[model samples]
Target: MTGERARVIVVGAGIAGVACARELAAAGVPVQIRERARVVGGRMASKRFDGRPADIGAAYFTVSDPDFARVVEGWRAAGLAREWTDTFVAYGADGRRAVPGPMRWAAPGGLRSLVTELAAGLPVTVDRLVLGVEPGPSVDGTPCEAVVLAMPGPQAALLLDPALADATRAVQAQQWTSTLSAVLRFPHRRWPDFAGAFVNDHPVLTVLCDDGDRRGDGEPVLVAHTTAEFAGRHLLQPTAAAAGVEEAVRDLIALPEPADHVHVHRWTYAKPAAGLPEAYHLDDDGVGLAGDAFGEPRVQTAWLSGRDLGRALARRLTA
Candidate 1:
């Protein structure tokens, strides 16, 4: 590691963190990213399942903002992203309903591909868990101009400096639930038309995706997501969760044979029901909080939050 003091240290390498880091670096600010995981993407990530990359976290994202749309366009041109579907089926207590014109998008390789592109050329340190933060200076004792906390609310709270936490008390963070995802590989293809399915009021299955159809990969991959209630109950048991999710998906898809392989993933902070109003929360003490928890629980919101924070920090630095 170089003995240089970074102008800003953006914690977490999820969409928010990477977006923030990209914006800050583009503005000519000396920035460093710290990620606890070996990979760069946090929740918008992927894992190898049965010799194929599968998205275990964020399946797809929607773009609404003009700026975000432009970014997606760039990604599309670079062959990193492609449209999944403009419509989706929502399953609820009543029944199944198809909503059109939603414009769901996905990365060609996996959601993590986009994150990797965002992290390109940025100084990212992986597997370094930040236990806590104190109000003082950088490790070298040089006063840090800014610090961006791009982690989930609970995570940020645990790592926040004592004084900063006190000042940001009013920034209430919503209680989140976990999710257990199972990527099941099948011998034969399934779902001829639809790429995904949202199953609600089901005991074990909440969402199921036909990964082959979704990514146009021509492989038999079924990604099953468990209900929040079920996930909370069996979050500790990976094998149990994976089995349950596989069974649920098999039933949902009415498969003739069992899946070849099953892989389970747990998301501690899946989504936030209620979030902070500010796009990016900031304190006069040079600490900022930005994440999907600060807005609607979505990839676009995470990106927007980080972009807003990066721009804010740039303005402050220039001033």
Candidate 2:
């Protein structure tokens, strides 16, 4: 490792962390991103399935805030994003209903592409698990000027230094349900009206999507997500539970039989019902906490929290 000390160390490479890093770097502050995962894009993510990029995290995010809309505009101009649809289908106890109006956007390659684009000019160190933070100096003896904990509140609490634990404890962390995402490729398309559906009150399935229709890729891919309750109950037995989920998805979408290929993914901290105190929380030592947990758990909230932290950090560094 280099003997040089970074002006700031941002933990986690999710949207919030990347945004904070980008904002800090743009302000001429030397920042380094340490991520536990092999690649960036904490939750707004994707992976290769059957030679095609499939989004297993956030299906698609909406641009509601003006500031976030500006960022989305930039992403669109850069060819990293495109409009998926303005209409959505909701599958509840009453059956499937088409709802039209709001504009929805998606990345051409996948959701992870957006995070990669945001981190283009930032220095990100992947596969570095930060067990905890120490007072005075880091384990390497590098006196970090500032530290940003940009992960779920519980995860952040685990890594907090003793000095900050009590204060941070007041910032209530809610219990969130998990999700199991199954990506399947089909020979022919199933749904007609919309690209996705919100299956309600089901035992195993929650959402199902026609990937081909959404991305205009012409390849039939079905992505099914398990409900939070179901995921938590069967997280350990994925292979055994996946068979039942596959069967449930087939029944929901009216598929003749099981899909061609099925991939199961488990997200321990999928969403947050409650959030931290503020958009950006700065400790007495100039350290900050930012992420989806800091604000609303939506994609826009994550971006907004990061932007807010970036602006705040820039002001602090300039002062």
Candidate 3:
């Protein structure tokens, strides 16, 4: 570790944190990112399953905000993102219905690659798990001018100190849903031809996506997410949780049991019940907060929240 570097420590290397650091760096403000994971891209993570990459976190993002659209355009031109689909099949009491909406965008190398691209030149210290914040607004006791908790509201609530009681109260009031994801690997693709399936009214399966198709590789892998209710019942025993999720996916899609074993990952804070209107929030202590939970819960909202916070912190630090 260098004795002298950026005085700002941004925790959580997810899309929001990385986007914040990128904007701060671009504004000529020194910033350092600390991520608990071995690599950046927190929720937008992609892992190799059975030899191929699978998106186990966020499936895809929607672009609508003009500013976010501008950023997406840059990523698209750089070959980081491609349009996945503008339609999805929703399964419910009325049976399957095609729902047309905004064009959902995906990345060629998995969604995580897009976050990595955003963090290109920023200084990030990975594998540094932060526990809590101190009165100095330090992240686990590393003194810094400011600290940015760019993660889920529930996770961030745990790190906030009493010094920011107001922020803590607000964050604690936020409720988040959890989901269990199973990566089912198959020798050959055998599911119906759809971009992704929204398993409505299903007790176990909530969403299922063809990983190969999402990545635009035509590889045979499926990622299925369990309903929050189902996940809450089995989050502790995630491995055992995979059994039900895999079975539900198979039954819903009318596919045979996966030839290979299914891989499971749990998201304790999958989505927020409500979002704040503000882009970024800060307190008198120089501690700040930003993420999808603070604004609209989506990839673009997360990025925008981070960008706004980074710029605000830059001004405060430089003042």
lDDT of each: 0.80, 0.79, 0.85
Select the stronger candidate by lDDT from 1 and 2.
Answer: 1
Residue by residue across 1-319, what tens digits does model 2's lDDT show?
2344677888889999999988888887888899999999998878897678988888888888988899899999998888888877887788878878668788878888999989987889899888876665352345677788787777777776667654266334545668888888766766465678878889888888777776678677877889888888877876666677888987876778567777788887888867655776776666677777765678888888887887788888878
Off by over 4 Å in 1: 1-3, 92-97, 137-143, 166-172
In candidate 3, what residue range of length 10 has the lowest lDDT sum? 1-10
Q: State TM-scores per candidate.
A: 0.93, 0.93, 0.95
Best by the lDDT measure: 3
Question: Model 3: clashing residue pairs?
Answer: none
Candidate 1 lDDT over 10-62, as tens digits, reads: 88899898898888888888888888899988888788765567889987899
Return the clash pairs for model 2, or none.
Answer: none
Query: Which order, best to worst by lDDT?
Result: 3, 1, 2
Clash counts for the predictions, in order: 0, 0, 0
